[model samples]
Target chain A: MTLAAASHGFLSPTGVEIAFVLVGIATLGAALMTVGSRQLVHAALWLVVALGGIAVEYLLLTAEFIAWVQVLIYVGSVVVLLLFGLMLTKAPIGPSPDADSGNRWVALTVAGAAAAALVWVVVDAFRATWIDLDGAAQGSAEAAGRSLFRFWVLPFEALSVLLLAALVGAVALSRRGGGAKGAAETLAPAAREGRL
Target chain B: MHLAYPAVLAVLLFCTGLYGVLARRNAILVLMSVELMLNAVNLNLVAFDVWLRDTLHAGQALTLFTIAVAAAEIGIGLAIVLLVYRNRGSSDIDRLRDLAERPSGPDGAGSADAPRQPQPDTGAEATA
Candidate 1:
């Protein structure tokens, strides 16, 4: 019944494919703009489009769990932090003098080579690999959550620690010169002076 | 058709990001490029994982971890960039080339957070 309704909607396979192609193009274009554009805020906004593309791709692949996480973490948190950094540091909201500097040619060459190599390796390796993909393997959100806590506990715990450390570091970095006379001592003055 | 489609896309995104990181002088952009590269890797992982059909959803799990780590990395990375910008007043990576190519004294021995020009006044400063 639900699948019938879904097919009638724009979420059918053909519709989904069309959506994918359109979104994919938009995503790629926005990503290119994100890198190629001069304005900082514009770049960050483009990043939202790029990240949104990946989330949609995940949805297409039936990886619902990962897709929402992408939206939550990258789009919700990371980009906001990026924007915050831009504002806090008082970077020239206008034309940044050093936005594109000396090594563009070299960077382009190296990036092209790397991309070629990566594509070559993938094509060569997966030449004969058949993908038997469907929605069944993706399972439910509850199942994903269970696996995350049950089997992937170690990595999850490690992530928690990493987040904790980042929180501490952010606090220390943003703190006014507290003169705590500890490991944070070396960091405090610079942060207070906003020289950090 | 094949996973190659996504894989190729990943490669292209990664490379563009790499170029941005290397070619762009702004520290913020470099960080943005780094995020792009990481996302490329995530896409490749998830695509392959879906293709493989393994029992554990290992690729999805790993991508989650990567996102977490990337968040932490950006946090610290931005902090350092903010510091450098404050010290040097400019985020141009080349401005620090002097510190690299030659051995300078305390005169050049501050954080890169200082700016080379006078900072413009914000609304608060304008009113004051």
Candidate 2:
């Protein structure tokens, strides 16, 4: 009885493909906006949109596990870090004239050439490949785990060490000139002048 | 299921990032561009994984690692940018030329963070 009404549903392969194309276009637009916006905050927001769009593309590609991971990591943590960086660095919330360099034309030409070459190479290489959307081997958690534990354990552990090192480096770098010695040095000049 | 669709999209996104990295002066903006490029690479990885239909799903697994590494990278990168901003009073890469490129002579020693012209008021000064 419930199956009768579901025959005219929206979850067809054609529907998935359409969503993929639309999301791809939207992602591209958001990516362009991320690079084009003069305001740093706007660029960050645009990055969220672009990253979210990529997550959606992952979903459309039937890699649901990776899609959610993308959301959890990229959208949740990375963008927040970026925002903190922006705030800590005191980036202007408004349009910044200094956001762009004078070498835009040169950069654009180089980027265009790279993009063209990449697209041509990828398209030609994968011209005969087709992914079956309803295949049995879904890129699920189990599959990812199997590969990660069986073949990629060393690299995975190495990444964890790298993360720990990065954490330590961030802490040490940001600590900077923050001790009694630093305070004393600053007060030394004023002390000599009898001001402090 | 044309593989070129996602491939083309990823390429476009990556190139946009490349342009941003090269053309943007702000350090944070360059980091954002780097994130964009990483995202593009992730999309391609997932697409190719699905295309090959591997049982182990190597691409997706590698992508997870990539995302984690990217998070670590941004954390460290932001800390360095903040430190530079605190010391130099500017996040502009052009202004940071002295930080990376050391001068061998004694004459240039005191001019590491010196600006060529008077800089406009950056809000971080009050906080600094």
TM-score of 2: 0.82
Clashes of each: 16, 0
Q: Candidate 2 lDDT, tens digit per residue, A55-78?
A: 999888888889889899999999
- Over B1-110, each residue of candidate 1 has an lDDT whose tens digit, in order, gives 25555676777788879888888877788899999999989988888888877578788888889989998999888877765554445455665454453344545744
Deviation of model 1 at A35, angstroms: 1.0
Candidate 2 collision pairs? none
Best by TM-score: 2
**Which residue runs of candidate 2 sit more than 4 Å off their true CA positions?**
A1-13, A178-196, B99-128
Q: Chain B of model 1: TM-score?
A: 0.76
Model 2 chain A: worst 10 consecutive residues (lDDT sum): A1-10
- Our tally of clashes for model 2 stands at 0
Candidate 2 RMSD to the correct structure: 8.0
